[model samples]
Target: MTNFDKILEVAQKRQGQSQPLKLQDSTVLLEQIKNREQDTRPLNLKHIESLAESIAVLGLIEPLVLDNKARLLAGGHRLAAIQLLKEQQADKYLHHFPDNRIPIRMLPFDAESEPDLALQVEIAENEQRRDYTPNEVKAIAERLRTAGFIDVKGRPKKGQKPLMPALAVVIGKNLRTVQRYLEPNQNTEQEKSTTPVVLLKQASTKLKQWQKIEPKTPQEKALAKRLPELLNLIEDVLSNEK
Candidate 1:
């Protein structure tokens, strides 16, 4: 079994239950969690805000995991979101966290000595995730624009904060990539340029360039021998194109 599986098995043997503790009480626990130095993943502000919003509506679905000594082993983002909610004084949402307390599950592990296990658990918790596809990302960007959450320029309509950057953070994409996905005209133009005629011209130019180069390497010689066959296939494809 993997380190996480072993930890989970141990936690299960020990009842596998979570209990509530005052948020303030966790401060010392957080300080004691020594794995922070190994955690290189930066905390995303937009992601924290999104989490806070969900937590407000649905409450925290997953309880934070802790070690035997009450040191944090996972759920850093959830903890940050809870702290943000507290700072915002969101009374309605804070109702779930009665007396400023949140649920946490403790595993019977020695975090101080088992540093590798602690780091493994932390990595397993964070890395076992999925991301949105390019099409889904485009759809989400379009929906946000249509909803007026973002303007034509991909900035917030009224607020000073730029929506694109915030969105980039939330979606785990760079600003330029998000911007490109948001541009309908750019996407359409790219589609238009992929016609059979355009492809044929591009391929023919590349073939001529390859023919001029004298093949030196074995790989190059092999590829040069197949160029004539490749040209025939390209010609057939173009001829069949409507």
Candidate 2:
């Protein structure tokens, strides 16, 4: 079967149940959608700009998928492109977009529950992607484990469903291959050598967290103001370490 067929099969089998598609403000959805930790896919600025241009003319062909609270289950790149377009205030597209609301397919969810289907959908969507470097895979795996999708030993977390098996399905790899990528060795020579990529991921995570910080205190305000310089210094340190 073709790759699209495989993706459709995975989506149909793993998505549990579907809900009716609805319209939501892109701006509001942007605010509410929480990105998956495992979603470490790098954004392509050229691709995003090209997509925004196409969207301006052809309009959105596919709706975004989200959970109940507007947390993104998939379509990270698409959402990013739309946000970019909005930031530029693309007037030609605005007439077609209408209050900046885009179509969405909302998935079933419970915030307090264990291992919602949203994660399953995320893995499925992630599987359809390609061209990830070894470093990117390892970094994504680290984030997945840290988010409690998997345990310290790289097994699925307690009360959480099996991630490796599902990931294997999406990734089209054998369980062992998937395991090797998902489970990192603490003292491995390769890991020690790839420290810079790992440090880069941590730095990116810190910047994301900083975005959420309120900056109420004087120290916080100072840190906020100098965040760009801090990031530049961090980059220099990483380069020297490398």
Candidate 3:
């Protein structure tokens, strides 16, 4: 049997269950995998760094998802973070990941032939998730602090780093946002700003940044024309805030 066939057999045996595989062993298989282009989301460097930090603290809690053919269906950011950790030779995290092995969960579908299924999995993995509430996160941080993971000021104790940033990574939230949640007295104004309001503020910032650039391409010109209306609508909605 060929190498691919052997890998497939092993993956089939462990289907739906996570199994550790060495990074070096998967190097050739990584090249053969398909459907990577289907993931259109841009990689966030900060998120990757955050993942690396959390992985170092807690190890890999969620395994990377792969299809029957070893095609990555989700956890692209996680894979990148593991690669970063390996490259940095993070010795402190070595015990958690022996021999550079990472856990992977192989699905029972071929991503190349079942493109729609692959897309659905990708969307569900990335979007169909709820974040921890502010109070819930605060409780977790407090527990860690009480356990001596961090000092009273939330700074690292011994070699253990502040759990706030790591918790932010685990919950997929902004570090500053998580820190605010841990505050003894959270600002009422900030509490009033819901997820949609925060998203709109981010969009407004991006649009204003775009306004500073001169539109040269046809697409850019079209977007530039619509920018004013979009900005006006955002301002109108924000102004109506209670």
Model 1 clash pairs?
Answer: none
**Candidate maximizing lDDT:** 3
Clashes of 1: 0
For each candidate in turn, give its C-alpha RMSD to the true structure in angstroms. Answer: 12.6, 21.7, 14.6
Model 2 residue 202 lDDT score = 90
- Alpha-carbon lDDT of model 2: 0.58
Report the lDDT of model 3 for residue 123.
73
Give the alpha carbon lDDT tens digit for every residue of 1-242 in model 1.
55556656654555545642212223233234333444447677878886665566446656676777776777777778778877785694557687566777665666676676677677876664335555666766554455344444643455543456545644656778777766767656666687667878698889979888999999999999999998888878878775
Per residue, candidate 2 scores C-alpha lDDT tens digits across 27-70 of 44345666655554666675576456445544564567776666
Candidate with the greatest TM-score versus the true structure: 3
- Those runs of model 2 whose alpha carbons end farther than 4 Å from true positions after fitting are 1-34, 37-40, 111-116, 126-242
Every candidate's lDDT: 0.64, 0.58, 0.67
Q: Clash pairs of candidate 3?
A: none
